[model samples]
Target: MASRDLVTGKIFSLQTIVGILGNFSVLYFYLFLHYTRCKLRSTDCNLKNLTVANLLVIFSKGVPKMMAGFGLKDFINDFGCKFFFYVHRVGRDVSIGTTCLLSVFQAIAISPLNSRWAELKVKAHKYIATSNIFCWILNMMLNIILPLYVTDKRNNTNFTQKTDYGYCYVMEDGTVTMKIYAALILCRDGFSLVLIVSASSFTVFILHRHKQQVRYIHRNNLSPRSSPESTATQSILVLLCTFVSLWTLSSIFLICLTVLNNLSLWLRNTSALINACFPTVSPYILINYDSRVPRVCFA
Candidate 1:
């Protein structure tokens, strides 16, 4: 128990600090770089959207759990619990949606100069901006129902029949109804997953074709023009792959947590931490790839 608690505390501390610094660095770069240029790329706007969602996630999920690790578990009220999970769900959904938008936008932006998508690339900024707004509105509405089912453990301590997860309480009014809600949430997430896979597939296909063309041109001239678009696309690909892997692993662990009987507190907390790990991991990917961030740290 001591070792588990020690590990959990250290991990939580690491995640919170890394997430704050990394996401904040991304935000700062966008501010300075975009403001100085007095222009924003479509990808930059989408990156800002993603960074903001991740910051929301870190604040909502990471901070509370960090506090929990430090033995401040009773600080949250019922409303706090509901609000935490609500924000957590919204941030996660928005992150997925923004990633899909980024992939789709990049695929459009990097289309062949003569292709139909090239025309859309000229107007990519408007499309990306509109999509970010739509993602925020859509995710907010999709997760609004979350608070109804989640509450603080204080409320549950009075009820002997309640199910508590150390930090929060789930008041299961009806098993069937909860199952239906879970299915709906899963379906929503599944739809987002499909969008990401489709967009990523399209991006990959376009990049492959572009690379072949570049190779042919380079063979002729013995010089290749590297594309800013391709470099950015590579970064997005890393972000997409990392997010999907973390989300998938977290989902698998979640499924097991539900199916297994009398799960240990360490297992339960670790699974929840895994779900929060993506935000911490993703910001660093963006920062490492982005040119605007100072090069000295990476060096």
Candidate 2:
């Protein structure tokens, strides 16, 4: 019942509610598009998966943090802690995985027909579904160990309960096995980061060239109404930039929180808050990105 917890709780509670509403609203748009279309486009397919990934993030991480904020400090037990962290890690990892996929797929979608990437577009549909399944498998396998390390902090005297957010981390064993496992996890995330950046960069490169081509044809007199491709590219660029900025900030702070033992609690909450904002904002971006979709569909 500390004053700080009360304040933090209220703020995160508001964040969680906003996240749910925003993501679900986007979900509705996707669902409507799915049933109405004769066939689903690769972008829509990737986005549908992204919607699920973001929702998983909200349900997995946001809800627990919100509960903890509402003074449910000890509401969770050992099993509950295990379940919460398990789902949270899986959801967190999957969100990043899906983002990487979305970036790559969109990049491929916009690639020139003669380009090597465009050749893969034919298989993009199948590749996306298969990749989605692979992503889920990889995330679940990698993060299943998270719950093993997490337990109810109240019952354990040896490990310090983290006060930054809802979950507690098990004390590091310092054994070679634990060290290797840590490295492996870092490598997984590192690869995901590299993919995200590379994909975003390539997308922007292609889009820039595309814009130049259009400019040459129109003599720099572009139409007020944007083409679907143009709108999609702009949307992807904004989404990728926003995602990378937030992801980098959260990753840096979370690593610091884990490595530095003397950091204050406020910093930890700040990191969690950053992590929570991405899911909420991303859905709105997706919904508003294309003026053609919902308006045309509902009309």
lDDT values, one for every candidate = 0.79, 0.77
Model 2 TM-score relative to the real fold: 0.91
Q: For each candidate, C-alpha RMSD in Å?
A: 2.9, 2.4
Which residue pairs come into collision in candidate 2?
none
**Model 2: per-residue Cα lDDT at residue 77:** 80
Q: What is the Å distance of residue 50 in model 2 from its true position?
A: 1.7
Top lDDT model: 1
Best by TM-score: 2
Which regions of candidate 1 fall more than 4 Å away from where they truly are?
1-3, 113-119, 156-163, 175-177, 220-225, 295-299
Off by over 4 Å in 2: 160-169, 220-222, 296-299
| Candidate 1 C-alpha lDDT tens digits along 162-193 | 44566787665656866777887789778878
